[model samples]
Target: MQIEPMATATEPTRKIVQRDPARTRARILKAAIAEFSAKGYSGARTVQIATRAKSNIRMLYHYFGGKDALYVRVLEEVLLRLRAAELQLDFESMEPTDGILKMFDFIDTHFGARPELRRLLAFENMNQARHLNRSAVIRDAASPVLGHIANLLRRGEQAGVFRPGIDALHLYTAMVSLAYYSRAHAPTLSRIFGTDLLCHQWQADHHAQSHQMLLGFLSRPTTA
Candidate 1:
């Protein structure tokens, strides 16, 4: 018995296990974004999101309530990230023309980084009031960023920099439309245009041209 102590099968080695709730939540959020982006809120399913997240339905609900709640949370998170990025532009230091260009650059980068955001937003627009109401808390949170942009526009107008007659809100809407619509509808546009409208080179050129065009439209007129 003591002889060669029957080499006890080294107690099956055990791998250390670590639980990462935060990481799991992030994974769920990421999967939810893709799911909702692909199928609008009405069409999106919680089980699908959970499955994509490699998580269980019960865990998904526990973390984010039901589908509607999860959709709202996803939108809120997206808006928060967008606001943070937009806020980094130092409008106070930038000339109106330069600021407008900076905004275009910012939007271009944002869309590139999060194409799904545009898709998700397109879905939201299909049922504007319903989705907006569901995410009202996030919209409320966005007021500060909106106010900051409005203030910048006011200052630009007062300083005789930006065109005087354009409404800031309208201008903001136009800017957003320009940035989002092209990419969002790229496939359709490419088919109609008989070219790859979203090709890397095309997008780069289009972005620069669009930024220049907007800047030209917004800049103060030169008197003869």
Candidate 2:
């Protein structure tokens, strides 16, 4: 599931007049995300990442230790972005269904905007998640969000708007799978179906279907 680099033409070389360590490091991390997403851990090159960042290989190593370290950072950053966004939603204060739908829409919009994340995840999974498993930061990122979802579900059940006995992890997994599977498999599915799954219309239709499916499932009443 490796993606072709979004841009392969190297930027024109420019002389360094001033240095901003924070900005420079951020630039390198951004470049690393693109490189790893495009080529995966094994295929990605340090030189390509350096060139994309307009920095040198030495700085990349300096900031991130090495290719493996940089790849781990990329994994952390992408997952952190999603988790942070989820945390920012005052879903606790909002009505249960509204909060859940808002969460769904956020995930949908985030994936649509950053297909690189889908690519990066696919790349890591292909690697047996050897790199991702090493990062404690990444491992612990989901707890709060899962707890938040559980609380949201509790509220919904109390209000009789959502079914009881839902597992937060299960719900979260369902939400992600519904949102992710289509985009991740778009190309292969497109070829099989003889249609452009990446097209705006196709994505929009799938989004609507996913939203309906999840909402309907959650809103169903629990049987006695």
Candidate 3:
């Protein structure tokens, strides 16, 4: 009698592997953000981002198509994240001046936490079309908040809390200028001031001073 292969009572079974696409995608995005922020769109390399994400370039392309598409996705994700955080603010509860102060505090803290974000945004400013074309969702999401902020300015003017004849658009641009310039040019400012302007202590002082300066300007009486 020819003996066939005998079945073992205790056979090891192969385990099924499951990959978390969401987690992997998030990791890729975060890595891409850092890469793009540092090197910008043209200089950024997919291999470096993949290595940082503990992934491979093939997967990155599979998820985001290519480098340009990946860059756009990263931009969209960051813009959405920032907008979501800002939208949660309880603007109605605070006085107009206090709301403006809070805005400064928010910018200082948020931008401080993510210097890379400012870098990426600065890069976008250099190539407006490349980034702006991918920013439709961001603009749509921001429209309501912008409108709300404009309304707040109108209310403040009417209440005599802010000076009359100050354009809301101008004021908004001014606030953004103060925040963006401080952080974006921190290195140059640090060299000029002979101190690190990006330090937490410096940022705190700057934030307070900026808020005071803006409030003072807004409260000034208009010339006849």
Instruction: Name the top TM-score candidate.
Output: 2
By lDDT, the best candidate is 2
TM-score of 3: 0.88
**How do these models rank on lDDT, best leading?**
2, 3, 1
Cα error, candidate 1, residue 65 (Å): 0.9
Write model 2 residue lDDT over 1-224, tens digit each, in one string.
99887987898999888989999999999998998999899999999999999999999988899988889899999999999988899986799888888888888888888989999999989989999998999778889998888888999999999987889889888888878888999989999999998899988998889888988889956579
C-alpha lDDT values of all predictions? 0.80, 0.90, 0.81
Across 60-165, the per-residue lDDT of candidate 1 in tens digits comes to: 9888888878888888888778888888878878776677677767877797779878988888888874766766677677676667667767778898987777
Q: Model 1 reaches what TM-score against the true structure?
A: 0.84
Comparing 2 and 3 by lDDT, which wins?
2
Using Cα atoms with residue i matched to residue i, what is each candidate's TM-score against the true structure? 0.84, 0.89, 0.88
Pairwise TM-score winner, candidates 1 and 3? 3
Worst ten-residue run, lDDT, model 3?
A: 100-109
Give stretches of model 1 more than 4 Å off.
Answer: 1-18
Backbone clashes under 3 angstroms, per model: 0, 0, 0
